[model samples]
Target: MRRGLMAWDPQEVPASALADRLARLRAELAREGVDVFVAYTNIARGGSVWWLTGFTPYWNEGLLYAPAQGEMVFATALSKRVAEWISSVMPAGEVTTTPRPSAFIGEHIARDGAKRIGILELDDFPAGHAQAILQAAPGVELVDVTEAFARARNDSDAVERLLLTKADALAQAACGAVDVSSAHARDFIAPAESVARLGGAEECFTLVAGDLRSSRAFVRTDSMGSLGETFAARVSLAYKGAWTRHVRSFAKDAGVQQSMDRAHAALMDFSLQSGETLAQAVARTFGSLGEVNNWVAEQPRGSYPLAPVANMAESAQGFTASAPFVLDVELVTDGRRWVGARMIGL
Candidate 1:
């Protein structure tokens, strides 16, 4: 029998813990000779900001600024009414809705008189905004410190682990809700969404796979169409500030089971392998997958649901023991069977 999903509480990290994070981050900034650190986020890439500030951007652009010595400040492009509601999470300031968000960021830098500033995800940040911020603060120097910022957030605190576990349960529940035998893939959306909501998740996503020959990587689609005789469904959800995923398949034949067993073992090895670069682990674990199917074991394929940022490193050479992450792996058999799984790494 399939094991039941784990139950999780709805609690979150407290303010005192957030304050501790702020202190540590500021200390790190001092060591780097950066007078201030600015973290930018939209709907995606909010993980670093939320990890430190306990505030996630619901909509629009979000910015969090931390000085070497002072209370951290949170700002966003949201209006006054929304800012008021957000004050409970973090006292938010208004930034005018403009293409160049650095103008407001510069205003904050000028207000703080920060001489040396560091921005996270500098490589991915817009060039125009970076130039605007530079123009706003003529005397200040800007540096890309995404690596430093990501390192600081690598270790998951106790509260963070709890939230992730809860997300895992919700994801399992959502997967269990999918009806792979249905004629229309859209039929699974409602129950999956309801299960996620009832389980206290903030967001839910569901995807269906057709026959193995035509199965594609998970993508959001609105096509309400029938699935093949053998199909798979994947469900993922976000709870509090964490994310997790679960995949399920139903087959009319035993050939799929033979392939799934092989793939699942490989995935287990991939998830449990530690103290190695992500590429090395993948090569060692799933190298045989290529023999079975056309699948290739690739490196640097990892992400965080809490902060869905773009362009994360493909190499996992620097993953620390405490840093929480997920390994998303999928495979297909030559006989036309689909299998996918995501394992949490803590």
Candidate 2:
């Protein structure tokens, strides 16, 4: 029997569902007497920009304009295509693609008859943006909503449950490749040539293999080709993400196998003692409200006892299994071997 990190997509949250969520968020802004909520993204916000429009713009800026009295509108410095996509989420907002985002925003605020303004950033925004907004709407109540916006944006999106499902699968494939390489024969062509081969197909795996050939089994490297070694990974302990998809094909090390045997026995003992299977533990973790962003942002912040599955609902045209579950979990034998659960599902 097999079970592991499953990848999946939740479902398309309708525009109305997104609107309802935005209404709830906007209502919170209104309660705080926030006249508007402004946010920008050169890349990704921790969560802010995506909350307003179902789209998190890359290489652009996004804004959420809410009047205490009228419908909230989203603003951005993206093309009409981008605006149209966001319009599906917020039918009332406008989009622009000018060079000076601050100036464009200032002009829009003034033109739209805004009186009180709540900018998303007071510290982060350039002084010029503040000056422009003030020049455009001088008499208006100009306050900052950066903190409020930050807190509001932290809430998870229901649609993200679907994206994470796909993310988990990608993470699994990476993990699978890692496992395959790790347990494969440690073939060191040499330092003279090892550096050159680091960026090809097996860069991530070979870089470490070369260092292990030269240094102690767990020594670290600064750079081996394009694979810049960041830190030392503990030899026996597989990191959460690293072990999520591929089971180490067992390197046949006596010590490693012995330790594995002990761990397996311990796991079986625990399972019988607790009256639950490993699958039950995973299910509990899955239900932990950590269903967003590859489940990387697990709420209440506790690592799942196993390597957290990266994605669990994304597959092919339907529910086809695409990743393995590498349980760093344990199973103990009567006295011979160790055991851990796995997902060999397609």
Estimated TM-score per prediction? 0.78, 0.49
Estimate, for each residue in 1-346, the C-alpha lDDT of model 1 and write its tens digit: 1012222222466767667666766666677888898877655555677677655667777667776666666766677666555665542222334444567778878888988898877777767677877888888888877666655555667877777787877776776676545666677456776787777776667777755457655545475466665666677666665666666655645675566657766665555455665556655777666532322221111123433221124343444534555555544555555565553464
User: Poorest 10 consecutive residues of model 2 by lDDT?
Assistant: 295-304
Worst 10 contiguous positions by lDDT, candidate 1: 294-303
Which portions of model 1 miss their true places by more than 4 Å? 1-11, 91-101, 252-318, 332-334
Model 1: residue 78 alpha-carbon error in angstroms: 0.9
Question: What TM-score, to 2 decimals, does candidate 2 have?
Answer: 0.49
On TM-score, the candidate that comes out on top is 1
Q: What does candidate 2's lDDT look like per residue over 114-135, in tens digits? A: 6667766656655766786677
Native-to-model Cα distance after best TM-score fit, residue 91 in candidate 1, in Å: 8.4
